[model samples]
Target chain A: MALLEIKNLHVCVGDKEILKGLTLTIEQGTVHAIMGPNGSGKSTLSNVIAGNPVYEVTEGEILFKGKNLLALKTDERANEGVFLGFQYPIEIPGVSYATFLKQALSCKRKYLGETPLDPVQFIKRLKIRAQALGVSDDMLKRSVNVGFSGGEKKRLETLQMAFLEPDFCILDEMDSGLDVDALRVVGQGVGIMREKCRSFMLITHYQRLLDYIEPDIVHIMINGKIVASGDKLLALRVEEKGYACYK
Target chain B: MAQKEIENIIDASYKYGFETDVETETAPKGLSEEVIRFISTEKKEPKWLLDFRLKAYNHWLSLKEPQWAKIKYPPIDYQSLYYYTVPKKKKNLKSLDEVDPEILKTYEKLGIPLQEQKALAGVVAVDAVFDSVSVATTYQKHLAEKGIIFCSMSEAVQNHPELIKKYLGSVVPYTDNFFACLNSAVFSDGSFVFIPKSVKCPMELSSYFRINARHSGQFERTLIIAEEGSYVSYLEGCTAPQRDENQLHAAVVEIVVLKNAEVKYSTVQNWYPGDKNGVGGIYNFVTKRGLCHDYAKLSWTQVETGSAITWKYPSCVLLGDHSVGEFYSVALTNNYQQADTGTKMLHLGKNTRSTIVSKGISAGYSNQTYRGLVKMSKNALNGRNFSRCDSLLIGNKCGAHTIPVLINENKTAQVEHEATTSRISEEQLFYCEQRGVNPEDAVSLIVNGFCKEVMQQLPMEFAIEAGKLIGISLEGSIG
Candidate 1:
């Protein structure tokens, strides 16, 4: 069985189907990249997986570590070690980043039947994770993405992903707004967390991210379905030759 | 979710409503001259007080309950309510130890630990009033040492008659309204605080009013007088028992801040919110008014979250030049509660300034309204006023309204008023839940955020309880 399996998933936004019979599978200890042009339903797939209420799954089976994933609520899926790095992270005013992250982390720990870290222990672990992602103490004190710059928000998302330490992560354009330096820091964080029990699905349009965090398999998605699959060089080919080759 | 239900054990309707089974001192069940005499004679009050009560009672009998407020309720049977029920144990009064544990437990249940704290340690003296009498008062000597008279209104009538004679009915005349008139006649007990001239009140003064009787009405009359160049902050909290028969609570509060003096009054009202079906809630019609006499200032901050029906408008009269007035309020109504409360700022002083920030939250078939008035006189040249009223509706069946009456006469005055009514969007709550916060916690977080602008103005202790009260009041408001 695949570590994360998507079998004939069909998702609809309102009355129109967005994800049409899409299927994919990734084994543990591997990274898979899904590259697509605009209007390819990449963001929709990430949100549907994260349990966005707007998207209705008409038909699908998403299995995460042998458990049915589509039946869980968004928070349940999160506590079950499924993380989604949003393309546009929400700006929640008056809610401090530290408070939000602590609650989320404690919730996940509680779901695992593990003891929640005391404030002191939690803060100590938070500083370590935050430092690994190049997050400043000031960022933790500020409201969640309230006035963050574009690069800072993407870095925050990366910091959240690192702090969560999920079994699998679907980065939805996580590298979109990052500068070269920020993207490198995020890539280094991801590389440091890469292990045999962890898997990642990188969704991006550019090949620059693929260069830093190389994927074992690169799939080309078009009009809601994966049409092409290849190794790392396929991303380079698409980067230089454009998506017209896959189309 | 089951854990949530268990944790909500304390979130049950205001539980301090235990009516003492013993009855000794009681007045006739009606607002009559005989009842006023009965209360005055029971307390051994002087003839002057009996005359005062009789005069006010006569005026009350001639007037009718005002109908201008947006609140509509079943006619209150004034004749059926036992207006006065003082505890018979006051005959053995001594120290805090002599106080009844049941009365102290009432405060403890209300989250006010009043017994052990050194009375003089804090600046605010608390007068705990239960049912129809003052249960206990703290920091009497300390307040007296500073020439600040702090006691129950009945005690003040006997001990500090000169101050009462000078300031009573001055700010809020007995003829002001029906509630005020009735309170003037048969008001059982409330706090009376007086700060002498040029003295800064060392502590906050507070009165906790608990309605323990079922059919008996609570008519408290609080009067705070800040002499020239003095300053004081007073707080009041009210709670009632759960009952199926509607209870009437008509209170009158008056404050007089003299020249160059400042007074701040804050209230966190959590009366019994009738059952989900709106069966037995309190009808709260209160009259609170302040007068800024020649450069004095008065500010009112309130967090109102209970009552089946609330009709109040704490107002200020700025008569002094350069005087200031402010009103910050957050009123939440859920599960059949109806609240029509706000403030009235009348600027007669030159260069006077006023700000009104009112927030209304309505859910579960409840209705809330922010009705405020800003009246600027012709002499209010260079005066400035800013008013913002925002309403948040939780369920589709609830409603929120903002009615701002702005009367601007001076062209030089700058008056800006803004109002917005919005529903608690699914996006906001979902954003919180996505962070692993449960639905109830998410709703509370958003509601707290919305009311932070007003809650921040509350005192440290009050701010914490007010936040918790908001969370508790919203227990079953959301699914």
Candidate 2:
């Protein structure tokens, strides 16, 4: 069975319907990218799948691990190994970045019925991982995403994905505001996680991020439905000819 | 002139003339001349103190309860409430079964033994009380070496009448306002601290350390004096939850910081709020103010989370050159609670500076208001004040208001005020929950973040656990 299965998913914000009858499936250890123009309900799919309260699922059956996924709360979905790397990650001042990631990881550990990590061991691991991702000790000590540059915010998001190790990774516009160097680092950071039997759902408009982390299949979503599905070549074709051809 | 007249008129024989005193545990329910006299007599207070009470009571008769705050409550029947109760309440403590179940429940929660709980609760008149003698003596002797006088108001009156007479009501006079006037007339319990010149108190004098410590109860009057070049930090209220039966609480706190002295007063008040429906809970009306001399600094840091209705303004009169005054507060209200709290900074000295940081959090059906005043007097050349007041609303039903009054009389003085009212955004909440934190923990995480500045002003342990206290205050507030 697939890790995540969305069938006839219809979502709405207020009285306006955003996602109209979207259906998709992702199996274990496979990477899939959803590419489309703006207003195509790309972000809505990620939010509804992550159980965001703002986006109401009018009709859908989202199954994770062969169980009803929509039945769980947002945190429950997180604890069950589903992670959403937001396009514009929220900035929460006065909460240390280190504390934020540690608490999130602890919650996942607790949900998995695992013992908490020792402070010394966790600090050592955090330092190593942070150094690899170019996150400074000062950044770790500072408030989470409060004053981070756009590149730094994406790096922190990648660092969080590294620690959380969700089974299904959804990166919504992960390459939106990245410099060339930051883009390479962030792309590689997500690329490294693709080896852990983790299914990836990369929602992007361009094929730039695909150069670093290749995807098995690419789905062109137009007006909330998968209009076309093909290999990585499809993303390159959309990037060159523009999304107008798909319409 | 009245003080001197009262002293001269208080005949020596009148002290012994008062009938040996009734054997009753409480005065009859009412406020009158007889009740004031009865309270003075029961406490064995000095004639001048009694006269002061009488003077305050006489003035109170002409004052009415202020209705300017943003809160609604039933009119209080002052005449129907008891003005005096024995410090050592005569509780029928034959067995634990006779105690209020709430008391026992709190005892169990605090892990206190039945006997110690009874003693702490002032239910019994135990002679061989909890052996705080050794502990108290240790700190008292240490403090005495530095010429520090730290004791209860009653003890201060007995041991150092001259000091009390000179400084009591000096900062906040008896006729300051309605509630302070009432507290002045019938205050039964409070703390008094006198830090001598050039001496620094070694410990954080907390009411929790005393074995015979009595809660300020409904009416508390406190006085603190920091002499020249001295330093001290005093902590009020207990960290643990307290079940107070009093529905109306009015307190007055006054502080005088002399030349080159600094004093930091921190209070963490957690009285037992009524049930979620707000059937019955304390109405905290407190007036706290400080006077700062040249180069003196006084800071009031308070974390108020209890009480159905809280009306308090801890202020400072910066009278000395280069003096500093700071107010850091975090007032959290939940479950039908209402709070109107802030601070006043009167910059009267040259080059004096004041900082005010207030964070108000409202959850459930609660409402909160941050009312502040920053006044720069005519002589306050180069005086500066910076105030940042922020309010966070948890649910849609709760409300938060910010009212700041800035009166600048001096052309050279500058006052800057900034305020922002924000509800916990769905994006912020969803971000936390998506990271695997539950709704309650998410709210607490966001709230603790919002109140970080004020919490940092608290003592180390209190600051560390402030997040948990805020969490507990907003329990059952979110889904």
Flag regions of model 1 displaced more than 4 Å. A1-3, A105-142, A147-149, A176-197, A211-213, A240-247, B1-24, B90-92, B118-124
- lDDT for A81 in candidate 2 is 87
Scored against the true structure, residue B383 in model 1 reaches a CA lDDT of 85
Candidate 1 overall lDDT versus native: 0.83
Error of 1 at A14 (Å): 3.4
lDDT of 2 by residue, B264-294 (tens): 9888776555557775566788999999999
* Deviation from native of the Cα of residue A157 in model 2, angstroms: 1.0
Task: Highest TM-score: give the candidate number.
Answer: 1
User: Model 2's lDDT to the true fold?
Assistant: 0.78
| Candidate 2 positional error at B177, Å | 1.0
lDDT of each: 0.83, 0.78
The lowest-lDDT stretch of 10 consecutive residues in candidate 2 chain A is: A188-197
